[model samples]
Target chain A: MQRRIVLDLDLCCGCRSCEAACKAAFKGEARIRHGDIAGAAYLPLACKHCKQPLCLASCPVEAITKDEKTGLVIRSAMVCIGCKSCAFACPFGVIDAPLVRHISQKCSLCADREGGPRCVAACSSGALQWLSDDEIKRHEIGMRMVSKDLFFRRKA
Target chain B: MKNINPKAITIKKALCPFCSYGCEFGVIYDDFGIKGVEYAKDGSSGGRLCPRGSAAAMYLNHPRRLAVPMKDGKPVAWAKMKKDLTKVFGSPKSTAVTFDRNVTPEEYAAIIGFCEKVGIENIASTYFEPESHLEPFLDESFDVSNLQKTQLVVILGDPFNQTPMVSQAIIDWKLKDRKNGLIVIDSLHTHTAGFADQFLRVNVGTEPLLLFALAQKNFEGIDATKVTGIDRAIIKDVSRRIKDSKNSIVFACLSFGHTYDPALCAEGISELEGYGRMKIVPLVEFAGYEGNKGFGSIMEMAKKKKIKYLVNFGELFPFYYPQVAPDLKNLEMYATSTLKHSGYTMVPVPLTLEKEGTVYTSFGKKKLLGGIEPPSGARSIEEIIGPLSGGSGKGKQLSVPDHKLDIKERARRISEATLVKGKGLRLMGEKIAFNFLGFFEEASLKMNPADAMELNIASNDIVKVTSKQGVEHMTVRLTEDVSQGVVTVPAETPGARKLFEYDIDTDLRSVNFIPTEVKICREE
Candidate 1:
């Protein structure tokens, strides 16, 4: 029952709605996680919900854990201390530093809201999508057989 | 959130008044005043907002903004303000006036009318007409779509990346399926040069030499070790790229006013033609400003005639064309402006919603007098243009518009009629967006080009920039990236204007300091 965020490159118009929405959902203002050029591409990224979570293993305080019900990686805010371990451990630099509060924060898929991740909802281009593990795997397998470049491989 | 009315958050499509890139922005108004602003969806800025546009809300609410109209340096009511303005301009006297073009068209017309009534219509001057074209950018025939076909692009004065939209377009073109090469010939390593395939750091003001040498395929003194301070092999490599390209496009970002050497562009035009189909594009800064270049063309025509009364707005004819302003001392002057030096100065624009009523329209118009709710204070350009165009029957005579009123079209009509007869060639129209204005404002560094990495100059540290006409003290800003022998200051600042040598003398005080190779030193 693991959930992974799926990307539809075709729908991704290179508009930065997800980036802005992600910042607003987690933090009050839209803060770019990295330099502009890095985020220029029309690629939306989220925790892959890998069979082995790199963040959970990397957390020294055991602050990060995969939810038993959803198999989604979750961070324990109360127990967590701001350390660079989880950030270094995760290959993808999804780890973000909240501008207001000096603490580590990441996309929680807007767990507090009933409607799901705010980024997914606010994306006017429908570039980012929520998907179950099976669907993500199926799409990846289908996409892999074709050109690996998701943006250019779309069939006419 | 104490029973906040949904109507309180009213979003009005307010035009950004900073630059010629008249970006329509959505100003969010609450019952209290302006809350925030966002880029209007329909305007040239699209949904993207730049730092200037984003910070506009702060500018609107800044405490230092001019809240009340002023007459003789003191606050006065709108009626008294208009009366004082009328009295000063009532006589036909030659006066120098500097005015901003952002005044509503209605105010523009009213000011023009005021000038005519007072017989001061002949010497009205504003910022350079060509520079102001950067605002209210119009869709031009010479567009990016035309640029895509180009294989070569050259930038002269202003760096491109500092102006992002244009830079982004050029970048996209360079990174296209079949990459197009870019050549940046500038004095410093500008951000625009970063994306260029090759950078030619030529000596400042020596663009003419570079162009001539390139045209003749002569490498006499252009050796990398000598001219550009680069490896000899690198020069050969870049020259090879230029020579090998089939379709070459040359771009110069420096204003024709500052650069003054049109022959270099002519040489570039000729060289590009030799290769294949080459086009030379002048990147003008103002909105509907292409019309101002027509004035330059007109002044050339006027030299042969015995005509009088050259009225300019958002333009300074003498500074733009030295051949004109000096000979026209008998030329009557009239204009309304926010600056202190203008022959007719009105209230300064204070930044805020509360003090907004204090700022009058460009024509010294008070808010809609005795009207309910007063139309929210900000006047539209169209409102000002109508009255000045003689709709009110109080202003000078103007040619009637045959078609629906458009600023670009009206400007063209006026330029055509005003041009000393028989010389009117249409120049290409230009399109600039609001966000690009933000980029220009944000990207241009205020540091002096000569000094680097030092800041502790005397509090009012003025640097002397000596040309033949004498020396002027410009405020100094120190940064590393600025090159020696070049001084970069904000073009709009008062200190910078003082540095601008506006004189008729060819050998001394000529505005063409580029050719003079004047040295700048920190003033004691």
Candidate 2:
């Protein structure tokens, strides 16, 4: 029952449209808070939903927890302060400073929405996707067999 | 200075007429005209600019803007201007006319009919790609993100500081690591050169001579001392330096000075060229040189099969020929360009900044520019071509095939597809992003403290930078920070280089040409 975000590395043209769209969805209500140039390169990461949850341990107030049914890490922003201990505790730099708000934040598995992560929805190259853990494993096996070298050899 | 009056300035939202950087600026003005300029924080440039943008007001406020069209030698009113335009070919036939700068959208439509009636074969709208249409074909892969994997980067004649986004990229590249070190080869010391790990200073015009010298050492001959300024010891040092690098890149802008022997330059670097590990990126001043080459070559292939009249709307022809300034004929040509000139003819573009248009080419699509609407009765190059080739009634319809997709969206798709396939890297595959390309186009790169030298030229000294056309002269700026042999002048000025003499006899050369011959002399 575990869920995952599928990535098609080859299909990713690296437009960063998803990054902009995601920033806009949360922050565009007032104004774009991030003063950094709009198109600058970014690594938009999400949690792997590890078996040993770091968020659960790092949260002193117990504001962060994992959903056993879907394996999605959930965060209660209402109880959280702006202290960034959770951001530091997460091994994968998935936590982003939310726009113009005084609270720690990370992807809550797009909990309010019906679809998957908004980043996947806005990706122009179809490089991002949400899938069940079983589906991800099957796809990974096929991808590994089709191209032995996705990250190492080819340089363009 | 204390007596000068200050004027209230207005921040105009107009896009920069330079390259795709699209920087915006505030124009300080009064009854006296445009006074000065500052970067527009809210505009495309995001409040930062190169020297050119900082000084745009000078060029635009220059006294010599063409207030009226000059037919032959007489300045006429708008009424007569249109009549003359109509008389040029009688009725709308098949003829194309390129404009200098600034034409309204409506006027653009009118000119199309003029070209069609005049029987213009093919109209090349320079307005569509001011610095030559290199934008539309750009993919997200060309964005700065690709620099993560970039190893060895090379910049030729272009100095990134002279341009905008490219300079920012250079600063970013430095933040990443010296792991992605830089190599710059040029006649003069450029801002791009200052940032390089290795700098190759070649004699002017003899850029080819230096390249040939390198090739000779690698293969045919070894007498490097006789061929170039660099001695055998230096060549060996340079050769070893290049050989040691795995992902080496060699690039040149060929704008400021000359690298006449690009083929030789390519061959010299060819020693380091490969499909993946090593590559050459050309830094071009004009936009769309590569894309235009692709389309033009294709059209040529079709021409061989008896195809006639290519209705080029969103395309530009590659200026394959080396950059050369227009020859100042019997009538003394005067211009103010980035390269100041002196002597026989007057250089104008360099002396003052003009309200120029911007050029954009992203994902292989080209957009010339937008500015204060051209004065009534004026025409744009696109308008001239549309009517000539049977364009839509008002020239409002884009020449793109009927699909209704936005040009920007289409261009993005094209860029994405090409990048995903990664096949188009064929012109020596080491993926050259926009910043890297900017590094190559502006050959005079950043220079280091030790490597840098103050040019002999001094401030206000009338010096001429020449090409085949003529020589242009301007007030010289002598800063020790500028690397020697590298002349740093603002390109924003259109004809600033017309003050210099060509040969002390007839003035018929300009500094606009690549590899221009320059001679500095004190005013008598």
Candidate 3:
């Protein structure tokens, strides 16, 4: 089953636990990036795992690819040529360019762990959730801002 | 065949010692060594770990983990160190014994036993962080279930960043009811303050004044509104609501250099707690223990050159607080530490994480399993103080000096102190678990956009901050969270910590690292 990690901006308190988990697992390079909306709301961004991956297309050595079985974006360290192309081509700006050993850092959704991404698992608040496409539809992620009180999520 | 793999992996459980939450997780080890930490779903806090808890594996397997004694950046033999210490102990009258964090309750008792045998009368605690003043508030056991049932919650500082494990509980409770009231009082706009129904932004180092005002305690000459920048009616109104609320809690988490007087801040909490008839829960990295004599006595002796040798237990003391280094002239130091430092006689010792003992937490005392051994050559307190062999005594509840608080004098001083002079900025300190004692990343300075614009500094630009006591260089981050004429930094490292000024309050006879006045300019 295909899955994705989604962050609820309303619940995030800008504590940066997701990024710390990534940095702890990997040496110091955080694959999951942290961004804030003008110091108001914390936004934890991850790989979209797009159908047509831009990082795979930009890779000169064909190191970046998608696994057909799991529909997961994979970055192979052995085949990677340490080129900067993949870091630049990512539209979401999730890929970190200046990584240790000059290799492009990408999230594999914690391929070895059975649960899910370490970022989602280590989230201090229940802001980050691993959901299937069907489960994602159920949340209707931005329902509060669209239908309910726009200010409610901003406060409370 | 699955269980017959040559490199078998073993998982051992341990508690995080970074904060008072005392979270449990699993440490994975193979034939080579530690791999990483595993989230324990059945453990407390529902397997949720903060940045500090997640950094446990790295902290254990860090390259700088000291395995042997070091002197002047070089390894020293244990026998040589013992001989030097023994000779220094010849004059026990001039030798002082102190302890700080990273010490278990058992280790503290052992230290006291060692002091008695060695005739070292100058006993004091060197862990002088402002959070130490909040130790009394942790007496009441706070249940996580209480967050959901309480109608009103008052927070003193930013617990979201300091103790992230508790964020979900508070957040879940606030979302459950629209009528729930959350009040935050802080000097700067913090993440927790953003979610508050009322954010009372007080003047720097004047938190005690506002808190006292909330309790309806007044100083005859001091105007609280003029000093704290908070409206008097709002303070009264919030106090009334808290007094009338059927169920409420006052959660306090203090930061270093954030207040002018820490003990006084605790007094304010006491007053508010009495007025509201509510329970208090203080969240801190460590619930510190005090010594027979205050640390001020040691400083006074050092200034007069009456002390010759100073022996400190645990990691933080003199290394973390270099501002007090000048007073100890010609005083040779012997300190037990987990990491190596530039100067001082560094004895390799086991951190509390690697030792089996009980530590005080927000809820209660919890035992450490000591599943992992200390690095090679690192000795326990039992071995270091072996000559004075005695059974470790019970963990004594040491109390801070609770003398009569002179409200008028303190209030007047704080009111006048917060009046920032023109072209000067007040430097405040805050605690961040992600910074992790500056072991992972360098400390950054947060400045108001207006101040940054005036200094011609931008984000990511280096700035030099100079105070009367010391100077520091840090990367600048401009934000409106901080008001104008104020700059804040996570004073986690030695360099950042050295910049702040300290005070030895004559009333309580305790040391307090208060916010300092500084001039900031873009570094060329």
lDDT of 2 by residue, B377-482 (tens): 3334443334434553443312312222232332223223222422111100011121222111221222223322233434455644443444555455444334
Candidates 1 and 2 compared by DockQ, better number? 1
DockQ of all candidate complexes: 0.05, 0.01, 0.56
Over B301-330, each residue of candidate 3 has an lDDT whose tens digit, in order, gives 888889988989988877898888887756
The worst-scoring run of ten residues by lDDT in candidate 3 chain B lies at B388-397
Instruction: Give the root-mean-square deviation of each candidate in angstroms.
Output: 12.7, 18.5, 2.5
Q: Which candidate, 2 or 3, has the higher DockQ?
A: 3
Report model 1's TM-score to 2 decimal places: 0.53
- Comparing 1 with 3 on TM-score, the higher-scoring candidate is 3
Model 3 accuracy (lDDT, Cα): 0.83
Worst 10 residues of 1 chain B by lDDT: B423-432
Query: For each of the candidates, what fraction of the native contacts does it recover?
Result: 0.00, 0.00, 0.63
lDDT per model, in order? 0.43, 0.40, 0.83
Mind giving the per-residue lDDT tens digits that candidate 2 earns over A1-156?
Answer: 667776554333333334433443343221111111122222345566777788678888888888788777777878777677777887875665554586665776556545556556544334467788678767753253135332221111
Residues B6-47 of candidate 1 have per-residue lDDT tens digits of 575667665444433334456667778766554455755453
- The number of the candidate with the highest TM-score is 3
> How high is the DockQ of candidate 3?
0.56
Instruction: Tell me how many residue pairs clash in candidate 3.
Output: 0
The model with the greater lDDT, 1 or 2, is: 1
| After superposition, candidate 2 runs with Cα above 4 Å error | A1-156, B1-12, B24-44, B55-63, B72-74, B90-118, B122-140, B206-251, B261-283, B288-359, B362-373, B376-496, B499-521
